[model samples]
Target: MNEPEAGAAPEEASTGAASAPSGLSRRGLLGLAIGGGVAGLAVGAGAGLTGGVAIGRARAAEDAHSAYEFFGAHQAGITTPVQDHLHFASFDMMPRTDREDLISLLQDWSYAASRMVQGLEVSATGAVGGPAEAPPDDTGEALGLPAAGLTLTFGFGPGLFENEDGDRYGIAAQRPAGLERLPAFLGDDLDPQTSHGDLCIQACADDPQVAVHAIRNLSRIAFGRARLRWSQLGFGKTSRTTAAQATPRNLFGFKDGTANILADDTEALADHVWVSSNDEPAWLAGGSYLVARKIAMLIETWDRVRLSEQDNIIGRDKGEGAPLSGGDEFTAPVFDSTAIDANSHVSLAHPDQNDGIRILRRGYNYVDGNNALGRLDAGLFFLSYQRDPAQFISLQRRLSTDLMNEYIRHVGSGIWAVPAGAEPGSFVGEALFA
Candidate 1:
């Protein structure tokens, strides 16, 4: 899609921004009126949240801009309401890139992200004509469009710190012990190129174009500082982060996130999600660890599985999504070994079996067309947030022998330290540098 160009104007002239839901705000139009001006009104959520949620301003027209706040105690995307689309990118620093360059790029990214989330261009000059020799600041495809409730969450991978030789960015001392390389597990087929990066950006929005535009502009801004390693475009979010949003289905047709951690669950968030101040690194007090896995689903094989077998493997009703042993969808599972398969997917991965450990999952379904083998290339792009990496590791270990593994393959994976959100003048991950 063409990026928003500065000269482009909206199709209709509308005034006044419609208020969004609590913890979400309505963003007004971005047209000829403010073509080259910075959005003095930065993006923000209506209700103050631990992790920010960008609320989009409802335009006078049908469902135009829904803005989510970008500044808060924690980054927005992790615990925010799940958007319809995801454009996740991992980046590697240039061989010669140093600490100072990394810091500069981060600052630039923060400013640009803050502006874009408000439905403004990356800079005051944006895509409009500037010095004839210089390219437009923003690509411009998103011009004249509302923010679409965009949220960009940033994270630093384990590689960002000490390398084989030693600390590369001179901040290895600050690396949290909880942030480390994820160990390989059973039935793993991780691709080296797609598995790891020094940094990552997760941009999500109700509009695909808006999400894509954010990543494109950020990559442009990074220029020689950091280059994209791998990115996946995901559609159909498989989880819910707020009570107001319904649980979404994954590509496998299962209702996912039925047991997810909602934003309103302050107790759960503190216990299982947010990193506490006493965790040694005072800078990471409100932060969380992000785990990403690119899972490949064998749709053909799954389609061939009998409905009874499918339900047996999943331990849930195919249509109603209720536990095989249960009453309603959200009713606590009985974990009855006689009624459900002992090796069922849910049975093994349930918190009951994993020392009562749970992770806040924010997964999305992905379809990347067909692979070389002429099979459908698609699966759940699993994303989860947790206070400690041990939670995820324990769950995966319990699922090593899950009946569902026959139809799914774990292909790519990475773990990153998602630091606390920035104040107005600060950039994401600025604490480490300080």
Candidate 2:
């Protein structure tokens, strides 16, 4: 299908008479029209348009094109308010039996999912090297055997996953960041301890409904071929502000992702995220990177501490993600300064101990307990995509010794090698170990 143009401005819903609905609110009716039209498009595409071939094909093409545009617009809209951040983790797998069967199932699932979500699409790319090294870029030219197994991932954007009342979680808008950042993020983090198996799929659809539907459908389709592992974390105000400004922030409430390298343009993506090589294989170039982390939140213990004390430990205002030393989200943290008479960088504070370790953190905050507890039960599920994982590990280890360690835990973790997109009929990992 069609891919959304990266960074396109969102389209304003028309306010004129032709664009208005008959009886319902314009926005409500528009939501129904888009959702219903997408469902019908998927069903028609899957059945091969036997009943209304011409109509089905036309509608499908039109919807596919519009979906991408919708995604761009949706991203722009949500980025403004910085509502919520959804963090996702996925692992690659090796098929135990019947490679061809596995491929068939995966393809079927991909097609089905593409139809389910607005602006959803799938493509194959080259795989990364072992856990410790960077991925090669000669993805298109090198032809390898089909992957033994594949596991895909999808994450939602802010506010789009909510219901009509904005209270419950539901799929509403499209937030396609697939083309924007996921490939490189996957490749740089793949490794043996973290690597799940053979093939990996990383996806970011326009909205939560699309992401949830796509992943579940894909999982059902690949049930026999591979096992799926998944988790999601939601972001509060802190992480969202950092992301909207294209910077990274951490759970400890520090301006964490400040040093990240930007990939604002396609050319920059090739230089920063994708891999290219002549010595290895011609087809492996243009492949990107992957990185994964399973971070545990230390909610139970953190709750014991007073709010002011907790804020002091994290180095930022609990509400706005601003530094305790004082500044807005994107402003440079006064690492050497202090808000209170007490030192800002305490001897064992998270930011103080880890002086130089930096990674691009895209995390989600979650609340799991009941309201009776008299407090919000939440912590960050952290995910960082980088050209390497070593720096990330070092940063965590440093935090492990700091005071924050008492409140946080590293419960689950894994890494995977993500491949770049390839031409049609070419499955992921068709280059390295064919």
Q: Cα deviation in Å at residue 145, candidate 2?
A: 37
Question: How do the residues 257-375 of candidate 2 rate in per-residue lDDT, one tens digit apiece?
Answer: 33333323334333333444542233334343344444445555666788788777655566665666677744455555556323332323333345533333334444444336654
Write model 1 residue lDDT over 1-434, tens digit each, in one string.
00000010011212333222121001111222222232111112111111112333223344556576676778888777777778888988877778888887787788778877878887777778555565567779899877876788999998889776567689999888878889898989999887889899999877766877888777777766677888877767888777777767777787876777777777778878888888858878888898999998999999999999988988888788788987887876787547678788878877666666777877887776677998888898898888899888878877887888899889999999898878766788889898
TM-scores of the models, in the order given: 0.86, 0.51
How well does candidate 1 match the true structure in TM-score terms? 0.86
Candidate 1 has its poorest 10 consecutive residues by lDDT at 1-10
Lowest summed lDDT across 10 adjacent residues in model 2 is found at 1-10
C-alpha lDDT score of every prediction, in listed order: 0.73, 0.34
- Residue 338 accuracy (lDDT) in model 1: 74
